[model samples]
Target: MKFYNFMTSQDSSVQLVDQAVLLFTLGEEKEAESLLVEYLSRHENDLSAWRALSEIRLSTKDFSAAEHACRKALSINPDDLTSNVSLARILVSQGDKEGAEEASSKARVLGWKDELAQDEHNG
Candidate 1:
């Protein structure tokens, strides 16, 4: 596979994932989501891709799908602070305050103290 100087060398180095993020940034949400879904099909264990998928779904108010993606990321790495926080937010949106708090508390304990909103919004 041809390498791009911009894309980091990693197991999840699917050009489609970067393209999806670009599409999303360009306000082409549908195309971005399509690309992400395609990328996920082959790179199911990619934490970054899962996180992006969850964020995109969340933006579209697809709570269930977002939660599923978040859970997928968590399954890959339960200690993923971002996924924990995302799961917390998804749970809160689904009116599961208890679950949300639990997830949030776990994220807190995991030392993910940074504000997630800025990065999440960009995604």
Candidate 2:
């Protein structure tokens, strides 16, 4: 895994996320989660951190927490395709088929929009 240069004069929030990613890669999920929680406490509007937290919770089978984190990320940016997909997975794990389908559809539409935007930019 690629590690960020912590010695560089980067933003503290970025450094914190880099550390959390390192911990997560080392299989120190609880430590990573704690770091992410700390980061979120200071940066509640950070969508990427919310998404990472959601993924960690999902890996731990904490479906409700995963959904909550996913929702938080979605609230920050409702058009985020990855968060919508994560929400779908979390809902599916919790046996909420309808919610999962809705999330899935949202993700699909977002993906299509992204592709169209890319095509427009390239073509």
Which sections of candidate 2 miss by over 4 Å? 1-10
Clash count for candidate 2 is 0
Every candidate's lDDT: 0.85, 0.90
Clashing pairs in 2: none
Position 11, candidate 1: lDDT: 33
Per-candidate total of colliding backbone pairs: 0, 0
Tell me the TM-score of model 1: 0.78
State the displacement of the C-alpha of residue 50, model 2, in Å, after optimal TM-score superposition: 0.4
Error of 1 at 105 (Å): 0.1
Compute each candidate's TM-score over C-alphas. 0.78, 0.88
RMSD after Cα superposition, model 2: 5.1
